[model samples]
Target: MVTLQLRQLTVPPGHRVILHNINWQEFEAILTELGDHRATRLAYSQGTLEMRMPLPKHEVAKVIIGDLVKILLEELEIDSESFGSTTFKREDMNFGVEPDDSFYIQNHAQMIGKERIDLKVDPPPDLVIEVDVTSKTQLDAYEALQVPELWRYEAGKLQINVFQDDKYVESDISPNFPNLPIIEAIPTFVEQSRTIGRSAALRAFRNWVRDTKNI
Candidate 1:
């Protein structure tokens, strides 16, 4: 019989290390041990686990994107709850993933005033934001968990993906915020934030959204 060993290695920041043949029990233990360490990201599917430490550039983009999402939600008067880097997992599906940022938009009511979220009973987040500066997204794990929406930012562009029939398909617009030009507008604002500073760029974005909505 071949038994897989739990191996550990040290890698540079933003590098991903794969742990092979790890079972659910061991994976849960590892997650518990890594608690509250916000810089690291973990993804697991079947028997494969991936761990990454995001670089500074990656984190900057992640924050800007998340901030923009919240700004849009607020300007639209849409209720939302942001969960930054929260680990979402499902035991029965043998999958687990942590998004750069996640939000409950349409499903915000269900999460109101709750201290802990259990996917087993509670509804999954309506939107998840992923910033892919170097690594590709682990879509298989998200698919297993049935997350409804995804926004992926890579190479200065944002792509919207909607989950349907157990798969994710690229979409030009978000179903929840259909009128907002999310794909085009977000990346543009991200660039503005980098050049003019986050606060100024955010104020401009809010003004733009208000004008656009009113027109």
Candidate 2:
């Protein structure tokens, strides 16, 4: 039987606590005990574990970015399978992580109608969104998982990370949105949501997409 004799540290919103020397069994047990409740996110890499609870700002960024991505996919007629904060893990690599939001685009057809995702069997998500409100995302963990693309939002700015040469390098454009300027477009619309309203902002965004893409 696996026993998790780990210390429980309660961190304030937007903050995280990291514990060292955690084994895979203990990490699995912790995840099982936590279950599907999403108030907190857990990440494990090698022998380290991190727990984070999203703040209101963090939540806002997540929703805005996720919604914009969905809009882009819809207008472009791109099929996607979203797994929001679903834990992606591989025991062999000793890595496990849950992005704020994740999606399967190029490989969406491969995961159709599936309830569970096994990283060992299925391809990793094509795009992962990270809202870095207080703590930095664990890039090493995602590297171990070999995620193709990552969008990290911090301080009202978006940074695109593309996997290349065994590392994630910051890029100005996304492979999925080669023509769209996502870095600038997303933040502008997200700010509009704050000034006008979500519905109004979304309406404007849709209009822009339709006019720009002739959709």
C-alpha local distance difference test of each model: 0.87, 0.89
Q: What is the lDDT of residue 30 in candidate 1?
A: 84
Deviation in Å, model 2, residue 130 alpha carbon: 0.3
- Once fitted onto the true fold, the runs of candidate 1 whose alpha carbons sit more than 4 angstroms away are 1-9
**Candidate 1 collision pairs:** none
* Alpha carbon lDDT at 103, candidate 1: 93
Number of the predicted model whose lDDT against the real structure is largest: 2
Tens digits of per-residue lDDT for model 2 on 24-96? Answer: 9989988887788658889998989998888998998799889889999999899999988899999999999
Candidate 2: which stretches are off by over 4 Å?
1-9
